[model samples]
Target: MASQEKIKLVLLACGSFNPITNMHLRMFELARDHLEDTGRYKVVKGIISPVGDGYKKKGLVEACHRLEMARLATESSEWITVDDWESQQPEWVETAKVVRHHHAEVLSSENNSNGDDVDTGKYRKRRKMEKKSPSCMNPKADRPHLNLLCGADVLESFGVPNLWKPEDIEEIVGRYGVTCITRCGSDAEKFINQSDVLYKHRKNISVVREWVTNEISATHVRRALRRGQSVRYLLPDSVVRYIQDHSLYSAESEQKNAGVILAPLQRYSKTE
Candidate 1:
């Protein structure tokens, strides 16, 4: 039986999403099923936040295209929505900040639903002085919990040197928690056990094993697209059509843009 009062939760996935793949969308469903099965949490929303062009990673496409592809991929889902806040930013925002921003938005929405005016100043002050548990809000309250949804690879990236701040890890895992959707052959649990911070907050991390393994990734999709191979089912039809229409990831386009550094504004334009 379901709990009488289940904690409301929102799932946030932040990434390059160069071209959002089917696996990226399936992660939300896997996490929702895993969490709701526990009878303690109900996933209320799923948000996909694509990184801005400032990340400057290899094989990363324009933020606008990635944002649009994400929106198109999730347009049919009732619970999933695309947030452009991170993508529209002038530079890449930290993952912890993005999660916190979404949490505040959730709290603001809950307040608005009850006809209460959100006092921004008071909220900021409270957050600054918060010394309690990870979640600054009362667990018994009706507020929704915002958890970061990520793949096992990202979870392991916590060990990458200088890639993530220790404090940011605490803020994200301690405050909001994480719902990691792990694929087959991944050693997600082993990684968690090896980290001191992750081990300390182990309860806050929930790992959902994806039984029906899928290895579809954006890098592979881009490669196939560049070589003129079929990617009909690897991604949504709408997204595939969008890529074709804009000639994205084509050999010509890739060669033309290869090794060329573009400014933030220049990176937002679609491929010719």
Candidate 2:
């Protein structure tokens, strides 16, 4: 059996890994490297959410297709995974439940070690971490750990009142700590001000502003591909291949002829 992945700290870098690119890798690297350097987390992994059955985008393809693409891109990286719980959910009502599930999975794995076959290298790294950092033990216990991932654009109204109740949103963020990544324009402060219930109750919001790297988003990648331009380097090669193979992100007009454009998924998660 595949040695169950060591689950330590859960850094939910949730996003619509539409095609899964190298930039995603960079982001994963950034999170892992940061956590490793500062001893902030144990196992920080990225969760890709491709909209499942419940939703639909004008030109978007099927949920399974997107999910497959994400999986394909992340095949090599043990730190990243394509989580379908949210994607496959019939509605957003199950968001909090899923968050708790992820948390339980992490904690349970740490407590229940299955066998004696341990990677000596991983063992050494764990030993070094334990020896050097007092904060490493029960890593989740004392530290202000929510989900640590960064985001650039955050809109308060993105939460459609009809679609999601405030309590629902609150439960997800509250249940699992959210370490927000802020880039300037995200109306973040407004969200905090408006979200008095979640924000005020928590000890302190965990947010960080690392350098805002390339602003080129998934949209840009699609546009470039549709125009027969190069989106290379901006996004990882895997994403490019998947998009090409699946023919995602064609021009708005081409979408009609091509059948599906791909999910218009602005999948808003706790962190992205």
User: Best TM-score goes to which candidate?
Assistant: 1
Candidate 1 on 1-272: residue-level lDDT in tens?
34647888999999989899999999999999999999888889999999987776667778889999999999899999999999888876788889989988887887778776677776556545543544524566456788899999999989875667788898888888888988666789999999999998888899999889999988889899988899999999999999999889866544544565543324324321
TM-score of 1: 0.88
Find the 10 residues in a row with the least total lDDT in model 1.
Answer: 263-272
Model 1, runs deviating above 4 Å:
1-4, 120-131, 136-139, 252-272
Clash pairs of candidate 2?
A: 9-43, 22-236, 59-261, 59-262, 60-262, 60-263, 61-262, 146-177, 147-177, 150-181
Best by lDDT: 1
